[model samples]
Target chain A: MTVDFNAIPLSQLSIGSSCRIGEIGLNGLLRRRIQDLGITPGTTVECLRRGPSGDPTAYVVRGTTIALRKEDAYQINVFPI
Target chain B: MSITTEKDFLQELNKEAETIRLSYVTKLGDRIIADIYKNAEQISKNVILNDTNKKNWTLKLDNYLTSKIFGYPFMLLVLGIILWITISGANLPSDMLATALFSLQEILSRGFLDLGAPAWLHGILVFGVFHSVAWVVSVMLPPMAIFFPLFTLLEDLGYLPRVAFNLDNLFKKAKTCGKQSLTMCMGFGCNAAGVVACRIIDSPRERLIAVLTNNFVPCNGRFPILIAIGTIFGVGALTGQLQALAVAGIITGVILIGVFVTFAVSWILSRSILKGEASSMVLELPPYRRPKIASVVYRSIIDRTIFVLKRAVSVAAPAGAIIWIVANTYIGEISILNHLAGWLNPFAQAIGMDGYILLAFILGLPANEIVFPILIMSYISSGTMIELESLAELRLLFIDHGWTWLTAVNVMLFTLLHWPCGTTLLTTHKETGSKKWTLAAFIIPTTVAFTVCFILTQTVRLLGLG
Candidate 1:
């Protein structure tokens, strides 16, 4: 079944848990860029750090550390395992 | 429960159960994955829904401004508008300031004479120091006053992220972090601040690239020199409606050229001296917020405009006074100002600028704003050592000395591409914590400036245009 990552709050995911990024609902370059970073469907992601701003959070995806603004991060649908 | 010692019986039982157990394991995995997906979805949805409720008009505005398509264009347009407004608006105040300050110079000169002050005192105080300071203020103040507020408004609006986005790809291609663009933007106001801003870029190699190239973007202090050259060299070519417009356009073009060269040199450095993979940049475009106009104006004018002006003035005033004294104080034959200019003359000629102009540039190294004043001191004191109150008179004086379009173009190029001033150099040294990089910063731009001027002067002379 197709599931949206936006349905769950990122804060609910404990650090070190692995998840698969589905769709990043953001439109345009930000969406394309996230997908390019291997935050695509079936890719494994691990929460690395929460930023002070409570946005611009970081995650490890496809062997690379990436930071996403909370807004865009919300748009991304990730299936956790 | 068949015993493994009865190998035949165990193998038969294992085969029968394997197919059934495999299905169970697959089902369990899917169920766990599904549950996790549902949780992440719920978390993200709840936060966004809450955000929508709390944020009102301000948040909406921020979103629009920081939207991918609109953000980059908006930032560029705002920057262009600020430059346009500054150039157009500053002209009136600048002329008035020059008129007012020069009149004061005359009054001071008369007061010194009336007080029966020695010729040397009058020369040092009125002709040397006061003239230089007055010239610096008249030329440097207005644009800075106008430009800083507009720039700060963008910063407060949180549009800088979008700027970083637009330039990220180019930086990535250079094998540098995209965050370097933000540092470069910071450099526009001041290279030192830009160097500090480099802390945002995580990779050591990329951060150094940003630091070394920060000075390529001219700061507030250097605007006076550029404006002077633009007004004199480029403006003279056109007539009527085109004249003023042409000047502003050329200056903008020159600034754009500086940005382009910044990227080019950065690319070269990243690929060669700082060889590394392109650091991944996943920048989040912050939602734009409503810019606070009143605060922007206050901070930009008081915090940045006035602050930079104060620094420039403080350094310039003493330099001016010293230059004036040197010009007036005779040592046997030529005054100190003349002797210094004479010494620099040969080297200056090779670089397409004269000795006096080059000397001014060196003396003005403490603060770029003082360059014009130093140049004026050298010129005025080279002869009668009288303080002129009007830009018209200053122009006439330059005309008397045979300054043409070539000199103006060369000056503008040199100003744009020279080494960072003493303060910026120190900032670079401190930021990098390395004398080697600091020296490289100085040498790279100086070399570029020399090469550009040499080619330009040669081309002009070859065309018989000079």
Candidate 2:
């Protein structure tokens, strides 16, 4: 089944969860930077930590730390670990 | 349904597919995997995806930056505009700061005299150390203030990622990470910051490549010396509109050299130290947004300019005082600075610079911005140097010190390629978590600087330009 990510809270997602990155649903550079960090379809990512503001979150994928805004993080679809 | 048998067969097939995927990932081949994943999904969905001929905006943007036709010229033009803004805006404030700071020097000198201090003490404290610090502050502050902000605005504007996107193919071909270009952008603000930015690359090998190549981007601290010399020698050659344009051309040429060395060093490191296949990168092109002007100014001025200035000042003030004392204090017949400069002269000449300039670079390694101040201190304290505050006066000072075209070219080259600052060194150590790589960072640029300058100076002298 195609996973629907809109139902889940982005902040609640755990670290190391494999997910499909979706296209940006909002306007901003930080949004697309998240996608550029390999949050695309079938690309598995591991969430690292919440940044200081707790909106633009940090994650590890392909061994890089990529920070994402909270609004942008929701566009990503993930299946729980 | 023979559940156990069916499940076992499915697991076996899945494991085989997994092995193939793992192999591709190890090869850093993201595109093939992406294609596979996309095709597999299409097959499973039972959809006829014949309409997939359309290219997306993201793909189109990537092609523009990475296109062989547009890439190099685009890079140069963008870099030129940034340099023009930095140079033009820096002029007024640099003059103002020098005037104010030198005026304070006069006040301090009078105060020292009024306190009944001896002439030698007054000379050492006021004329020697204070004047040097003032010169450093006045010259360093404006360029940094202007340059770092423009750079940060670009960063905040999300233009940097596109730059990385454009340069990624080159880096990948060199067996380095695409993100190395991003780190190079950071190096414009400071090499240490660039080193710290290397964390975005996942592979240890590629990260090391990024670290070693970071010094090729001339940092904010090094800008003052390069600009001064470029203006003096390059522009001084011509009069009228031609002079201004020539000076701009010289600065641009020097920057292009730094970038060329960055690519060369990255290529060398990848082939020798960290041999591997090129990685396929999937970068997203963010929609362009209107830059928040206030935020850019606030963050750039406060976050970058003030922060960097504070750090430079903290380290530079003491170094300024020490250089002053060195230049003024006599040992037997020669002052300490003269002796040191004399000692360094042969080696400096071999690299197309004099001992005093080389000494300034060595001392200024702590902060690239301080080289001008150190150089000024050496001259002012050693000889009967003028205490004027204008760029006009500053130009006279360089002319007085026997600065030739060769000296200017060497200074620009050295500024463009040298060891990263102390902060960058420490940051590289932290990011790479390896002392070996950090040492490589220092050695690569210092060696390159010496070789390039040696060739340049010799060539110039051979042609009788020197």
Strongest candidate by DockQ:
1
**Per-residue lDDT for B294-352 in model 2, tens only?**
88889888988888888888777677667777877789999988999999999998878
Clashes of 2: 2
How accurately is candidate 2 docked according to DockQ? Answer: 0.03
- Candidate 2 DockQ category? incorrect
Screening candidate 2 with a backbone cut-off below 3 angstroms (N, C-alpha, C), the clashing residue pairs are A21-A39, B192-B424
The residue-by-residue lDDT of candidate 1 on A1-81, one tens digit each, is 755534454435566687765544564455446655546556678875443323344576644456554445666666777
Which stretches of model 1 miss by more than 4 angstroms? A1-81, B1-76, B237-244, B385-391
TM-scores of chain A across the candidates, in order, are 0.77, 0.60
- Candidates' DockQ values? 0.10, 0.03
